[model samples]
Target chain A: MSIGIIGAGQLGRMMALAGYPLGLRFTFLDKSKDTPGAQVGDIVLGDFMQAEDIRRLAGEVELLTYDVENVPVQALREAAGDTPVHPAPAILEAAQDRLDEKQAFARHGIETAPYRPVDSKEALETAIEALGMPAVLKRRRLGYDGRGQHFIRAAADIETAWEALKGAPLILEGFVDFDREVSLIGVRNRSGETAFYPLSENSHEDGILRLSVAPAGQPALQSEAETQLKALMEDHGYAGILTVEYFEKDGRLIANEMAPRVHNSGHWTIEGAATSQFENHLRGILDLPLGSTRPRGHAAMINCLGRMPALEPVIRFADTHYHDYGKSPRPRRKLGHITVVRDDRASLDAVITELMPLIKAAEGGE
Target chain B: MSIGIIGAGQLGRMMALAGYPLGLRFTFLDKSKDTPGAQVGDIVLGDFMQAEDIRRLAGEVELLTYDVENVPVQALREAAGDTPVHPAPAILEAAQDRLDEKQAFARHGIETAPYRPVDSKEALETAIEALGMPAVLKRRRLGYDGRGQHFIRAAADIETAWEALKGAPLILEGFVDFDREVSLIGVRNRSGETAFYPLSENSHEDGILRLSVAPAGQPALQSEAETQLKALMEDHGYAGILTVEYFEKDGRLIANEMAPRVHNSGHWTIEGAATSQFENHLRGILDLPLGSTRPRGHAAMINCLGRMPALEPVIRFADTHYHDYGKSPRPRRKLGHITVVRDDRASLDAVITELMPLIKAAEGGE
Candidate 1:
């Protein structure tokens, strides 16, 4: 069977890699043949935003999925006429906008920071007054990695923040005084068979994910996160991997956002878990039996941003695995990642401490 | 960097899968585009036996390797003029003929079954008398999986066995009444750094490999096997994975044959070991630091001969990994394989018992 992926990024490339062993082929829809996915699978050169282009790809494959979240939901719904698109386009519609996402979470009884929709400067000031002084104003759509969002620390900064993100659908959320950030990845099949991986504690630098360590968070928190994710998947009638990021404050999880796709925080599962998220996503979407989400060991994943460190120094560590997406270097680009699997969390932390400086040095340039 | 593989078989396909994470690209040389390797990487449509075709592939990549064993050594040597072909063409020459392989093993203090070269029918009968009534006559070259060989049970069967295999250069060997069969896989880099995986106990049906369970032999036996493998690699100045099958009789190892490339017995390493054989082969050939060969758990790999069982039933067991080479069904053809990893050998055996019947039934043309 062949699967058509809407975006040819590293995620799609990994999905193809994971799917190939199950006797599945992949065709990627993207503008360039030089992408990471194109290097491994057939390429259908087209724009993800165009329904006709998506239809061209949908015509050739048995199922459709996307590695990128920015694809237009209407285009996907129209293009995927007869073929199935997993996670459903409706879920994408909800995940694309902040207000809709928070509403979905609320509907599922998941807790989130206080928020109110803001469309005008008058509404922004009113939302700030109602929510409190410390808040964040974010565009409702197409915001990721700290983009299209601004923080308001005081009343004086509220107008400046409004000025910066004006003329777009916006949401004002009360600032979360988070102690730690973590995420839970779950997979559900069409039959409603679901499996959830242990929480991964994530660290970010300038809003870009820098490090992730798996099997983090307390068991109570883990179970709570899984229950919330299951409820969300059930609500959406979802089939595929779903990731929810949470802010932990005083032993409680405040849901921040959800991505209806395989996530970067779960990348360590490639070697640390019994089955990886990419493979489970394919299995769940294809309606096969979901694999075990058991962690094999403690694992840490370090993202190599802007530039990748030399392969020799990284792989020299025992049980270390290197991943290079075959991408050219550009400032702040996610060129590759390194994963280290250890028997215990302390050993994992020790190695990460020694490994971080080398990776951080390379991010400056080469 | 790109590597050119001489044959687009399952081995080459797996090598590409392992190399991709390390940011390597592959181009393969084969007559048919409908091969396991071609499904994942670019294909150079040509015959592996033709020197000119190999030269075309060698010209396109920085490094060269082969998955199939029958490639003409002269062709590889001539084609890979400057571009390094790992395991070295010289090692391939030594491994191609059974007599030369045995001689090379003996030089490294590796014991083998007693054998004598034969030319004519008269010579075959004379050798049979010297070796004994219960013996085996095998062609000296291009023989595998019980092909090109005949068994001599008694005096009446001697002439018949000679008549069956008389036309080729042959060897009559004293049959090994072995207790069990096992293989040791070892890797050497260009810098002569060496690593060895634990021995895998193997089972065969009609001389075709059916099952392999790794971390099987005693620690003393593993050390002995490693020493022998190191000597053989040092003698040849070899780089890349080398496998040697052994007949374990009364706790002693009798060398059988050697393959100068990645072997099937090591497939369990893909999930069972800290680092897989395919990745290690690439790291070795590329002159990178060799990965740790620590076994993660007890693992059993069952070859899916003739046909593959349904993915649903096979993958129902937790920690089970399925690999389908996408080959058409043929009687006794190696089509795919399933690997089961468990925390203990008893658990591994239990899963195999349940999995075997399903796979065997599929081989009957399901």
Candidate 2:
């Protein structure tokens, strides 16, 4: 069977690679003719917002999905009329808008940070009063990876934050003091079979993910977070991979955000888990039996960004594994990632500890 | 740097897939334009034996290798002058000719089945008198998977065997009462570092490989066999994947034959080993440090031949992994394989035990 995916980026390319072994073909729709996924996919080059592109993609595939959520919800709904779109357009709509997402979590009895919708100057004034100073003002829709968001650390910063938002629909969220961030990635098939990968502790620098350690550091917190995420997916009848970002503070896990598709933090699954998140996503979408989720070992994944040439030392480590995404070396571009899996947490920690030094050496040689 | 492979069959396709995460690009040369590997590779279509095609491929790649040994050596030599054809022409020549291979083994003090060269009727008579009846007649070159060989069971069978292999250079050998069959797959780099995968106990039906169980059944015998094979590779300065077939009888390992490229029996390494044989082969040929040969777990690999729809049951088992080669369906064609890996040998045995019932079910469905 064939699958249609919107946004032909690295995620779609990886999905295509994972799906090939299962006898599934993928057709990717994108605005650019040479998007990363198009390198190994059947491409339909047209605007993602255009009805004709959506129609063409839906006509050729047995199922429909997305690599990114920026596609217009109307376009997805129209395409869903022909082929089944897993996770549904409603889920995408809720996820795309920060205000709607937070409200939805509250409705489901999930814990989330305090937030208030701010669509105009008057709304911002009322939200600031209730939320107090030192809050984050973010565009309600289309914000990702810390983009389209600004922190209001003082009373003097509120007006600047409002102006920086460029008159977009926005939300003001009260800051939550948390110790560390983690994520739970799970997959559910059409038959209601759910599989959860071990939770991963994530670290980010300047808002871009830097490292992820799987089976997270805290076992009780990981299990509790996974159980909570799986319960949410089950309640929604979600079919496909679901990633729930969370914060741990004083031994309590708080929901931070959710992604209906595969997330970057789960990349270590490619080498550490019995089945990768990408492969599990395909299996879920295809209504196939889910593979094992048990991890092969403790794994640490480090993202390769900017002009880093960290391949030499990474390649020298017996346990270190490199995965180059085959993209041009643009600044801050995610060219690849290195995953090192070992029997103990200490071994994995040792690899992560040396990541910076190795990257520096590779950069120096280049 | 990029490498060019001369066939887009499963071997070349697998090599390309393995190379993907390593940031290695491959250009595949094949007659079929839409070979499986072509979906993810740069394909150059033309006759592999043509001088112009060889020259173009050589110009496009930094290194050259063949996915199969059938590639005409003369064309390769002309295209890759000092570029290094891994396993080299000398290795291929020895492997291609049975008489030459046996002589070389003898020269190296390796034990092999008793055999004699036969180029004419007089030579055949001399061979028969020396080897006795209940022997086999085989063409000296261009034989694979049971092709180009026949058994001479009785006096009447001699005429038929001779008629079958009339005009080709041949060898006659007395049969050995082997208890089982095994193979050792190893890699050697230019730096003289050698890595050997655990021995695989193989089972065949009509000379076609049916199954391979890694770490074999006899650990001590397997280890001894691997030691012998490693010595042979080091002695030859071999710099790629090598498969050596052996016969075990009365607790003794006897050399049967050898192939200087990736072999079907080593397919389990994809899921069982820390690094796959295909990736190691590339690392070896590139003179990079050899990867760890540690097996992740006990693994059983079963080849899928003909149009059997056995994927469902095999996938149902939690540990079972599948690989489909995407070849046109034929009665006895090897389209893919399934690998099952587990923490212990008992679990592997249990998986294989479950496999028998599923194979029977598939046959009944057919």
Q: Each model's TM-score, in the order given?
A: 0.99, 0.96
Candidate 2, B81-154: lDDT as tens digits: 65667877678778888988887777777788899989887788788889898888999988888889989888
Which regions of candidate 2 deviate over 4 angstroms?
A31-34, A217-219, A308-310, A360-366, B81-84, B217-223, B308-310, B360-366
* Residue pairs in candidate 1 whose N, alpha carbon or C atoms collide under 3 angstroms: none
lDDT of 2 at A196: 92
Superposed Cα deviation of residue B304, candidate 1 (Å): 0.4
Output the worst ten-in-a-row residue range by lDDT, candidate 2 chain A: A357-366
Per-residue alpha-carbon lDDT of model 1 for A265-363, expressed as tens digits? 999999989999999999999999999999988999999999889988999999999999989999888888999999998999999999999998988
Best model per TM-score: 1
Clashes of each: 0, 0
Taken over the whole model, the C-alpha lDDT of each candidate is 0.93, 0.82
Model 2 chain B — which ten-residue stretch has the worst lDDT? B357-366
The candidates' DockQ values read 0.89, 0.63
lDDT of 2: 0.82
Runs of candidate 1 exceeding 4 Å displacement: none
